[model samples]
Target: MLELLAPAGSMEAVAAAVQNGADAVYLGYGDFNARRNAKNFSREEFAAAVSYCHVRGAKVYLTLNTLLTDRELPQAAEFAAEASSLGADAVLVQDLGVLRMVRQVAPDLPVHASTQMTIHNLDGVKMAADLGMTRAVLSRELSRDQIEYICQRSPIEIEVFAHGALCMCYSGQCFLSSVIGGRSGNRGLCAQPCRLKYGWEGKADSYPLSLKDLSLAGYLRQLRKMGVTCVKLEGRMKRPEYVAVVTGIFSRAIHEDREPTAEEINQLQAAFSRQGFTQGYYLDQQGPHMFGVREETKEPKELFALARSTYQSGEAQRVPVTFYAMLRPGEPAQVGVKDPEGRVSTAEGAVPEPARTRPLTTEAVENQLARTGGTPYRAERMRVLVEDGLSMPLSALNALRREALDGLTRQREALPSRHMGSYHVGARYENRKEPPVLTLSVRSAQQITDQLLELGPALVYVPLEELAAHPEKAKAPAGTAIGAILPRIAWDREFPQMLDNLRKVRDLGVTDVLVGNLGMVAAAKELGFTLRGDFGLEVYNAQAVKEYKKLGFSSLTLSFELKFPQIRDLSKALDVELITYGRLPLMIMENCIIKNRTGSCNCQNTNTLTDRKGARFPVVNAPGCRNELLNSQTLFLADKAADYQRLGLWAQRLMFTVEDPQTCVQVTRRYLDQEKWSPKEYTRGLYYRDVE
Candidate 1:
């Protein structure tokens, strides 16, 4: 059976999930998780809580999924080591640094890649497997076919989000909150700015960016058939009642291999939902129908109360045990108990100085032993041996039973934790050297006019799709070495067109190409082109960067989510690029926000999505039927020119996503110190205050 995984925000949620039917429960490790805002557990709380789940036969995973700064990596690694020492089944990770340093901490602990890794393709899964990731939580945006393909090809186990609140932006990619006010979603502080009203020049009273809750209860059979190893329910911050109701519905559905009833579906909705529910990107259905805002509706009292009753008492009598006892006069009464896992414990009371009055009856002995009401164990069977005149004191009998059970509980928790093998250093590992040059990523050929090309940069990058669409408008003149930036995400529906565009760009004599996501690496390799990795490649650590360097990438772009110091440290390992100027892309939503309102994309080429705060975020109609939401503030790092040289980067990629040709020229000159430039509206972005 596919494992039914549940989220536990609190110890109470853990009890509810395990009692209801979660095969596994995953929670945060200290504060290093994607849900730091949740009432996460302290170290002591985590140790005690996991023990409670352990006795109930439920596996516990520690979530270390948030991105870690270089300074915080050691602490995060130490936390994983502690969790592993406490007997956690596995640790879910996102940052590559966590993946590398964790092995040094707990060598035998299983590391499952978190969905925030955005592992949407088989190549990504393969990359994880190559790095020794035992399991992968595929991106929630993957379709059923794509997921099945990855499952078939991936060497590691696949875990998918079975139910949860769907983020409008893909996991691990959104920078809206971070750039807006320093609250980074990648580091577990998501303001959920998507839920705020963002209009497309319409009167619709709905939140366009907010997708309804994803309910995959109706598709468990399909996932099971596709060989998914685990179905994860996404609500660690939710109430215990919410976790219980959601876990129960999915557990029953998975167990019976049957679709949930409509009543059960409504109960799930009533438990907690945005507006109603959506199946989300699993089926590859992205459109207006998949959208919904948070409709103010309380959870059904009956359902909430019912789920609450499932774990009303923290002490759940789940562990079954058998006991053997011998009571004799003038000797101690010894009691031995054995738990299900073959662990045995015995405790003996003080000498049973013969009962003074009313010799201890067999009925009284059974009564005292049966009072295992408050403990986590239930005595299924017990065997008693006694002499003809044995008279045990009630206090001694009670003490012996309590001591034996207590010893049994300690024995159960004392089980040794398994360690994953340590990471071995490879010969390919190398560090950065020399000051980096500069590259320009122009959105339009108009921005790459002949004059701008005269500045003499190392390389100029143009979008392959845009170049193919308008070779005349996007063409680079003679003597200009132009590299094409391929699209980041390649869906099945867009793969054909993307391949055609790659071929067209190849035929156009553009051999230098920059790859975006993992899939693009394979595509660019197949075309026999020089590959430059993009920011979307998510190179966060020295190990990950070295891996890419070993893969033959000419130069890689470090993720914008890193601080200047972190980038400098990673750059010391390999050639890397950073977008020093231009508007940062906040999200690449599959569902077009503009089309959701007008039912037609007129290609107006210029329109804004007005938010509740009246901040107008630029929307670009991306190729392959996608939409890109640009950050309202432009990322300008002209003042950090010396820092780039000090960091020893490969180059500073000045992207011109929305800037005009003249502004591109001005920005280029300013970067080169050929001309002075300053902007009234600009942001330092993560370069100053990185995500946690």
Candidate 2:
């Protein structure tokens, strides 16, 4: 059966989800989740919520899925440990260091990889699976056919997002947030600059780049039969009523035989919608409407009224929550427990019996409530009509209300407030001034080893040629052309350059490396280097993350083609840490950009490219190439430090080369030093499938 997962922004929303029907609820506490602005749970609330969900037979997944940094490491670890202890079914996460910390704290807890990890293809799945990840959230950008291919080939269970808002940025491959507003999407401090309106070459009134929400309600049957284990909804920033309705709709469709009609989906669209819903990248179309157009609609007064009415209709009247009565010998007493549906009954633990009027204080009532594990939802003064016609003081009545309501069992709540937590430190390096994750191509082993020792890059992605030549020898020292890229390049018929590069890197005191070639990962294991898998391997989901784990790579980068739901699902299904910061290498071109024009091109010479910040990078135009104008955007995330820290990512990487290394390092460092640094806006780059 396909699980219908729903998003809840608060405790009330969580209850609504369970009440309506949700197989699992994904939420967060403090700042570990992606919806940093949404109202989330506190630590205590999270604990209570988890217990409530478990008791009700609903699974609770805590999102510790944001990227993290060195300074935020301690807090991230503590959060992960606390979530495990709180009985969290699993901790969704990204980043290697954070994963390591979680493993140390809760060895048995499942750590799902966040979509920010971006596992695109079978190789990426194998890599993540090897790393111990149990599942993968397939990227929404994949076509239905592509997802099926991944499912058939993957080593773990697969989950996908069936509905909700879409981002123009690819899940693991965006730098816009970091570059434009100091908030790294990879680290969970995305400012959503993409949602803003801007004029293109000729259009003035519309946001040509903004995307619509994703809706897959039409394909529920295909998803279930394809062996998908979960279907997620994307919205923690929505209202509780919205959560209830969406959950209700998806729940019926996924678990029951009844499929949703087009009419039901249309009703959903009217609830709270953007321009319109699309299938996202699932259909492989990049039309401007792929992401719905933005719309500003007033809140429906009727909906709010309907919600309040629903709340009242479902409320059980027993005692006022503020009542302050104490248990005494001869005062009037109230009796019975109230069910969630507000039915009154003589139950022991569900609701508490009324206590006698006595000297009562708020503290005493609070203590009693804690002891009884109940949260009072409503308070009212009910005359305890007795045969003797005796009445108590209003204070006494309040005390009684407090006692009864306080003692009621706590209920499930949604993810915690979006405002808490720290941004991953690595994102600080990913502002507008930084360079992309550059591949310094080379052909020798001896030259690049020393450089590898000095700079901890996003990844030292090596081409295939040199890997065959070096065949297990150490590379040369830093400061030479051969020092940075040569060793790992494929060189000989069977030189084993990958093993050679790793061996040399380890021997020269280098600890980290990145590569796409699967053979290189196995070879690196033989040499004992801390390895991270790269995008070239096409990791689109959590399964790929787990696959990489077994191969011995320490980290994994996500595919740049994933949509929002795919990103969230992948984050929730993994058991390893993930990463999602740095310059998104938009498209790995078959031919280098510099080949045609050694100087520059004027792609961003339009108004759509400029904002408060001056123009940053120019768009390069290759009029006849497979991808005609390539405009790569810079990452400038300085505001979302709290979010990344909460998600538990290890490092925010900046793919760099000597041409712009210092700028890359300084950008991150400056962002770390000052939490909010907005660079001049640059033309946004395409994360994947850049054709124009």
Candidate 3:
């Protein structure tokens, strides 16, 4: 059966979702979850909430889905183990390091790949299965066809976001909040900078970044038919009433196999909306219609009050239990209760005596046992074995029913035994004395000038599309190699053409490939090209580096979000690289910001989005007709060469985005000569400063 998964930021939210017909509730255990700002459960509160949900036939999924450093890995692993002991049905995780730690420490606890992992294709889902994830929450940017394609081929269960607030950038890929406000969304402290207004290409200020909330209430049945295991509702930061209202509507739609009524849609908007909802991504109709800012509106007190009254009453008939009773002349009367899962409990009452005035009938005893009012359970069926002329007091039968129900509740709430193992942080690699080599990654072939090549950088990476368009330009000095950089986001439908392109590039003598997303890793390996990991892998700790090494990556570029000290201490399981120059990409968006405003493609030109503070972030075209928003200030670290060299990295990549060929050459020259020159506007990019 398809599951309806709801978000629970607080204990009240847990009850609201469970009572309203959620099959499972995913919540934060502490500060480790993605919604750290939500009123997450305390340790005690988590235990209580788990018991509450379990007894009512709802599963609990703990959220440890965030990036973890080496120092926090052990603690996070221990938390996963604790959650397992507290009966968490599973854990959702983003970081490969955290996934590794959780598997090691709590092998019995199933792990799901969170949406923050940026998994959107069958290959990505298969890779996650290979890594031991039982389910994969696909990227919300996927269209209906893309989701159905993945679902058909995925080895593990597939989950799709049914209704939720849409992030302008893909989940797990945004760095705008961290770069601008020192709050890392990967660390669960997003300031929602995407919700703010900005100007596009010298145009007037407008809310171009904010996107309307996604509502697929009309598509749940279709998704179920497509073999989607679960549909998740996104709103952990919302109120309990919001959880109740939304979960109730979606649950009814799924259970009834029909769309929600007009009144329910009105209730959804009143609960919360960003100028109503959009199915833009689901229908593959993304454009200006998808952009909207949240407007202040009056609260729907009557609707919220009705929802609160329903959940808070705590009388939801969610679980169905069967009653079995036995009465004999000489033996004590006995009653047993069994839940749908086959968990049974029995209780004994006073012995039945010969009736003086009236004899007990099976109907009389069953009538008393069926009074399961004010409970989450309802008596679905009952069987009573009553001997003729046997009498049992009504009070005794009521007591017997209560005791049996209590025992059954205890049995239902019991935690499953899970194995816990030890986790030890691996030792750091010895620092190498050799100076790091330089590599170049350009947006287009035009950025590869002869002057830059004369510097004899170890390797030059050009996008696969760019290389395919200009196969003649796939040339470098004998000492420098040319590699193809795969697109950061590619749907499964594009894989056939992408494979053809990869083969063409491979036939061009390009033996190396740089892959930033997990979905492309298998294809790159299948074609026999050397694999190098990009920053999109989000390798924040040594364990993730080791994991990637195990995944067949010969080299990896560490995440730019890491501080210098954190990067310096990572264990070098394989060759590791860092970005040393050029503008850092803040967001890789599926929606084209330029096309939304201009209704045509002009991404090759110099375009930018100006914020309210006048900081202009460059926008460049990405593969698949998407857009990449580059940081306003370039990350220039030529003067910090010595500091980088001491970290013992294999290479320092100069990402050449939005830079002319001349500028790329100039920047490469400065880094090669170890010149102490500074650009008028440049940033260290979270290297010198810490992010929350």
Candidate 4:
């Protein structure tokens, strides 16, 4: 059976979902959740909500799915312990650090890889299972074929977003909110800058970044047949009425094993929608058709009122219960209630008397025990053992039934046992005594010149495709090494070809690979390439750095979102690098924004998006014809060489995205010589100031 996972922002939303037939609910428990802007639950509220859902036969998944700083890991681990004590069915996590902490503090608690982890391929799912995750919520940008390909071979359970708002950028890979403003989506304070309008080549401003909300209510049966464990609905910030409408409809569709009716679809749209729903990603359709902005429309009061009434009645009979009654001539009459979860409760009533004119019948006993109304339980089966001539008052049987049901409810609400261990954030692994060296990452082989390689940089990373195209570039000076960079986003269907490309590069004597996503990690390792974690891995905390090291990464680039103090305090479990120069990437979009606006591949041209403030953010071509939006200003820290060196970094990476070969050479020389120079337009990134 497929689980209908609904989002709950408040107790009202929890009630709305459970009462409307949600199999489970995921909600933010504290400030550590990605939906911190929602009306997240407090400790008291969370406990109450858990009990409420448990008794009603629904699971509660605590959301601690945010990037945690080293300073916040201990507190977040403590909260995970609290959630375990309260009997959370599972926890959804995005940060590897939080995943490590949860495993340490609450070993018995199950962990689900949140969609924000950007798990899209089979290797990613296998890696998640290897890391102890019981399930992985794949990225919403995957097509049905891609999803099916992964699900066919995944070791752990698979979850796909069935209905929800869509993000233009792949989840966890977005930095627009943080770079444009001080708010970070990874930290749960997204300002939603993607919703704003931007222009292309001085064209009319339009919402190229906003995508239509996804709706797969019609595909529940297909998803279930594909072996999906759960189908999640995305709307933690939505109202209780929206939860009721969406959950009820999707639940009905799943239970009926059919698509939703036209009327139900209308009710879904009336409840909430951005223009209309889209199945673009699932159908492998990507273009202007996927773009839409939320338009203000009149609320359908009647639909909302009816939806509200379904949950507000508080009489939803979801859980099934069985009753066993025993009546003897002299002994007390007893009634026992049992739920499907094997929870049993019993009550004894007054003794039965001898037979009267109206004797107690099996049918009569069953009639009284079956009146489980006004509760979340329904009488599914009944067994009565009455003596031949036993007479019992009807009121006595009713009392016994009520007491047993109440006891059963109490039993169901009781917390399940869990184990918790101690956790502590330790100091740095080792104090680095060596000064940091220079490394270069280029978008194409064209960015790599003989002069740049002559600088004797520690490593020069070119794209795997670029190296495959120009395999001769794999040769470098003895002091300078060459590596291949895996694509930031590759679906399961593309892995075989990606592997072939990797093999080609490896055959050319390129022994190093820069991995940005978890899916690429296993593949790169399998090919005998030395793994170097890229910025796309989002190594924010010391624990993640340690996690990457455990995954066989020889080195990793720390997240640009980190402040200098945070970077300084991170554990140097493995060699860590920082981007000292480049136009920092803002968003790695699945949809090609350049082609969406220009109706052709203008990637070779100097394409840029002009924001409302007239800031030009360059759009560069990525693998699979995707687009990467670069930050408006370059990250220039060549003048802060001493500051970075004191932090004990292994290397300072100069990312060359749009720069030409000559410019790349010039920038490498500046960082190599430690010359104090700054571009006319440059930013220190989030290193100097804190991000919200």
Taking all chains together, each candidate's TM-score versus the true structure is 0.84, 0.57, 0.98, 0.98
Model 3 lDDT per residue over 201-259, tens place: 65548999999999997777799889999999999999999999999999888888898
| Candidate with better lDDT, 1 vs 3 | 3
How many angstroms is residue 438 displaced in model 1 relative to the true structure, after the best TM-score fit?
1.9
Candidate 4, residues 651-685: lDDT per residue as tens digits? 98999988888888888878877444557898999
Write model 2 residue lDDT over 122-229, tens digit each, in one string.
Answer: 555565677677777755566676677777777887888888876654465555565444565665667777666544333334453466688888888898777777
lDDT agreement of model 1 with the native: 0.80
Rank all candidate structures by their lDDT, best first, as comma-separated numbers: 3, 4, 1, 2
- In angstroms, the error of model 2 at 11 is 0.5
**What global local distance difference test value does model 3 have?**
0.91
- On lDDT, the leading prediction is 3
Instruction: Report the lDDT tens digits of candidate 1 across residue range 1-692.
Output: 99999999998898889878798999987778999988888889988877887867688999999876655666776688778888888888887767777777787888898888877777778777876789999878888998888787778999999888999887888878887867888889999888877776633245888888888888989998898999999998899999999998888787777989999998888888877888757877778888777677765898989889878855557677888788787777888888888888999877655556667666677777877887877888878777666576678888888999888877777756466444443343333566667789977666778778888778899888777876764355565578888877666556778788889888877888888776567778888899898887777767666657667788888888878877766534566788898889989777778787777884447767777666678888666667888987788888777776777687888888888888888888999888878778888888878465
Candidate 2, lDDT over the whole model: 0.52
Candidate ordering by TM-score (highest first): 3, 4, 1, 2
Off by over 4 Å in 1: 202-206, 314-412, 417-435, 445-447, 467-480, 492-511, 522-529, 541-543, 550-552, 565-571, 639-643, 676-680, 689-692
The better-scoring model by TM-score among 1 and 3 is 3
